[model samples]
Structures are given as structure tokens and as C-alpha cells.
Target: MAHLELTGLCKAYGAICIADRMSLSVPEAQVLGIIGPNGAGKSSLFNMISGDVQPDAGTISISGRDTTGLPSRRLAKLGVGRTYQIPRPFGGMTVFENLLVAARFAGGLGASDARKKCGEVLEATELSHLTDETAGGLRLLDRKRLELSRALVTDPELLLLDEIAGGLTDAECISLVAFIGELNKAGITILWIEHVLHALIEVAHRVIAVNAGQILADGSAEDVMASKDVREIYLGSAEALA
Candidate 1:
């Protein structure tokens, strides 16, 4: 059975539709990449799956159990974890404190267990050096790492990442790509929505392109980028095709 599945998902705001009858599935340990233009419903799709917003119509299942419209906290317990396009770490809290909250609330761990998990996550995300730093004072890269660390504290089976590589320098993006590759190797299933095509292509086993709330292409990363429709959509942005 698929690790994560979305069937006939539909959402709209007034007359503007987002996620119009969309369906997708990701197998266990597989990395699926999602790409689209701005406002093409990429983030909205993540929102629905993570239960930040309810779809008007759809069935979402994780590990074959139906989980449509479940609240975020409940979904977190069910092994769903995600990072937003914009990192939202608690400003005044220390990095360790921020991760501890996720472990306690999202992972439902006891104090000791939460501390253990937070430490492990910090090590995994390479943020141990910043443990005592205030989250709000972190640099962009550290903040992004904290976002990833927080989600991982939940020990999710299905991890959703939204543009985790955005705004990084090329070298930093390369480092992040390697880090994400390591995460996938560690057995976390990933569903990534990113405009950084090269980074996504490097880590994803397959890729899908969304346009106007619908899938325009789905296949191997190379093939999807080479698709006539995808090329047309990214016409002038040659980097997206590269």
C-alpha cells in the first residue's frame, strides 16, 4: 500500500480553485518532488495534506488509513510532519527549546524522551552548535535547519517539505541537497515542493508538475522537466529546465 495517498482532493476560495480533484500517492521511503509556478496550489496542497486547511472533497490516507480533514496535532501523532515555505520558529525561544516543544506536543513524548529526541534531531540537522542561541537571532540557514529539525522531532513516516532550499547560496543549496539525500537514506518518506529544480531533481525519485491546481506532468525528474508542457510553463526560466 502507498505510504501517503490523496484522492480527488478539491479546495477553493470563492471562485478560485486550488487543488481541483488532485490525486497522488507516494510509496514508503520514496521521495516525490512537486514543482509549479507561484500560486499554482503547491503550498495549498501541502496545507490540505497537513490538515492546516480542509479540502472541500477528498480522501487522504497515510499507511492505508483514511485521515482526511484530521487536525494538525492529530496528524502529527499519526506520523505526518512538514516544514512551511517560511520557517516559523518561536522567536524568543532557544533552538533547543523550540525542538523540545515539537517533541513534547507533536511527538507526545515525556520530558526526558523529548530532551533525548530534541538532542538527536539537533545532531541530525547539524544544529547542535546553535542549541543555546535564540531562534529569532539565528541566521537564515540556521532558521531553515531549525524548521527541518522541528518537523523531524516528531519522527514522521511521511515528511512534507516546502521550498526548504529557497534563498540559499548555490553552495548552501548543494550542502542542503546532500543533507536531504541523507535523510531519505535514513528511511523517511519525503514529499517536497520546491522551486529549486536542481535541488529537487537531485533528491527526488520522481517529479510532478502542478499548474492551476492540476497536475500537468508526472514522471522521472528528467522526463518531467523535459516534458513539452512543463517546458512551456517555465519558458523563460531556463534554470528550471536545467
Candidate 2:
């Protein structure tokens, strides 16, 4: 069964449609990348899958079970996890504390288990040295890592990543790509929305291009990026197709 599936999803606010009968299915353990222009409803799609936004129409299924309209907290317990484009850690809390909260709440771990999960997540994200540091004090790279850690602490079956590589240096992006690759290797099914084409290309097994609330292309990463429609809508110029 597909790890995640969306059928005929439709959403709109006023006259602006964010998702127009969109549908997709992602097989287990696959890394799928989504790309589009600004205001293309990429994040809106993620919101719906993560249960932050209810679709006006359609069904969402995880592991072949209906999960439409479920709340974010409920979705988390069902093994759905996500990271925002902008990292939203508790600024006043220590790194370990923030991870512990996700482990306990989202992961539904008991106190002792939550502590063990936090330690594992911290080590996995290479944030062990900063475990006692305030989340607000970390630099951009560390904050991004924390965002990933928080999502991973939930031990999700399907992970949604929204532009987690947006503001990193090339070296940092490479590091993150490596980490993400490792996560996928560990059997986490990932659906990533990223404007960093190279990073997405490195990790995603397949790619889909969305625009104006509909999918324009879906195929292998190279094929989708090379598609004329994707180039025109997302890259904005034929020069990128060259």
C-alpha cells in the first residue's frame, strides 16, 4: 500500500483556489520532491496532509487508512510528522526540552521513553553539544537541524519537510542532504517541498511540479526538471532548461 495518498483534494479561500482536485500517491520509503513558483500552493498541500488545513473536498489516506480532517495532534500520533519552512522552536526552552516535548506529545512516549528518544534525536541531528543551549540562541543551521529533529522525534511513517534547506550555506546544505539521505535509508517515507532544486534532486526519488493549485508534471527528478511545462512555470525562463 502507498504510504501516503491524496485523492481529488480541493481547497479554496474566497475566489483563490489553492488545491484544485489534486491527487497523488507516494509509495513507502520514497523521497518525493514538490516544486513550484511563489503562491503555487505547495505549502497549502502540506498543510492539508498534516491536518493543519482541512480540504474542501477529497480524501487523505495514510497506509491505506482514511485520515481526512484529522487534527494535527491526532495526525502526529498516527505517525505523520512535519517541519515548517520557518523553524518554530520554543525560544525560551533548551534544545533538549523542545525535543522532549515532541517526543512526549507527538510521539506519545512516556516520560522515561521521551527522554531516551530526545537523546537519540539530539545525537542523530548532531545537536548533542547544544542540548542545554536555548533554542533561540542557535544559528540558522542549528535551528534547521532542530526543526528536523523535532519532526523525527515523532517517529513518523510519513514525514513532510517544507523548505528545510532554504537559508543554508552550500556546505550546510550538503550536510543536511546527507542527513536526509540517511533518514530515508532508515526507511522514513519523505515528501519534501523545496525551492533548492539541487538539494531536492540529490535526495528525491521522484519529483512533481505544482502550479496554480494543480500538478503540472510528475516523473523522475531529471525528467520533471527537464519538462518544458515545469521549466516555464517554475524556473520562469527557457534558460534554465538549457
Candidate 3:
């Protein structure tokens, strides 16, 4: 069975439908990248899959278990980890402390185990040197790394990333892409919703475009980007995405 599956998922707010019978299946450890125009419902889709929003219909399953409508906290405990577009670290906490909390709560580890896991995550994210720094003091790139570290501390089977590379320098973006590639190689199933097209192309094995609450295209990264319809829909924003 696929590690993560969404079958005929639908979500509507009154007359406005945000997800229209969306369906997808991701094999274990696959890197799935989602791209589209501004109102593509990409973030909404992440929210639904991460259990932050309840779908009006259809099913979300992880490892053959129905997960639709489950709360976010429950999803976290079920081995689903996620990062937002805007990083939200605990402002007063130190870098290691932030991940330690996630390890203990989300992964159900005891204090010592949580600390060990936290150390591992900090190393993986290249934040070990800043373990004592306050989270609020991090720059944009480091903050993004912290977001990723927080998710990693959960030892998640599935990782949902929503525009984690939205604002970064070209060098920083490249580094982030390389790190994510390494993570995927280490067996983490990832679904990344990103406007950063170049970064996605570097990491994702498959690319999909979502528009107006539905998937518009799905295929190899090159093929999806070359599709005429995708081009027409996102003509002006190509540079930003790239």
C-alpha cells in the first residue's frame, strides 16, 4: 500500500470549493512536489492532509489507516510532521529546546531520549552550533532550518512542507534543496508545496501542479514544467518560482 493516500478528497467553505475531489497516492519515501499559481489551494491541501482542516468528503489514509478529520496533534503522534511557509519557532526557547519539545511530545520520547533525538536533528539540520541561541534571534535561513528541525524531531514517517523555501538567497536555497535531498535519501516520505520551482526540480522525483482546488498536472519535473497549460497559468511568476 502507498504510505500516504488521498482519495476523492473535497473541502468547501460554503459556496467556494477549495479542494475538488483531489486524489493522490505517494509511495514510501517519495518526494512529491506541488506547484501552481497564487490561489491554487496548495496551502489548503497541506492543511487538510496535516489535519489542520477537516475535509467535507473523501478519505485521507496513512499506512492503510483512515486519517480524515483527525486533529493535528493526533496526526503528529501518528507520525505526520509538517512545516509552515512562515517559520514559527518558540520565541523564547533555545534552538535545541525547540526540537527537544517536539521530540518529547510528538515522538513520545522520555526526556533523555528526546535530548538525544534533538541533538541528532540539530546536526542533520546544520544547527548544532547554534543550539544555545534563542530561536527569535535566527536569521531567515536559520529560521527555515529550525522549522525543518522541529518536524524532524518527531521522527515522522511523512513530512509535509509548505513553501519552506519561500524567501531565501540563491545560495541558501541551494543548500536547503541539497539538505532535503539528503533527508529523502535517508527514507523520509516528503510532500512539499513550493513556489520555488528550481529548488523543487532539484529534489522532487515527481512534480504536480494544483490550481483552483484541483490537481492540474502530474509527471516528471521537466514534463510538468513544460506543459503549456502550466505555462499559461503561471506566465509572469516563473522567475519567482524558479
Q: lDDT, candidate 3, residue 12? A: 87
Model 3: residues >4 Å from true position, as ranges? Answer: 236-242
Q: Give Cα-based local distance difference scores for all models.
A: 0.91, 0.93, 0.91
User: For residues 1-242, could you state the per-residue lDDT of candidate 3 as single tens digits?
Assistant: 99999999998888878899999999999999999987788889989999989999999999999999899999999999999887889989999999989998999999999999999889878899999999999998898889999999999989999888888789979888988898888899999988889899999999999888888889999999898778868775456556
For lDDT, candidate 2 versus 3, the one ahead is 2
Candidate with top TM-score is: 2
- Flag regions of model 2 displaced more than 4 Å: 237-242
Estimate the TM-score for candidate 2: 0.95
lDDT winner, 1 or 2:
2
Extract clashing residue pairs from model 2. Answer: none
- Identify the runs in model 1 with alpha carbons over 4 angstroms from their true place: 236-242
Collision count of model 3: 1
Clashing pairs in 3: 197-241
Sort the predicted structures by TM-score, highest score first. Answer: 2, 1, 3
lDDT for residue 37 in candidate 3, whole number 0-100: 86
TM-score of 1: 0.94
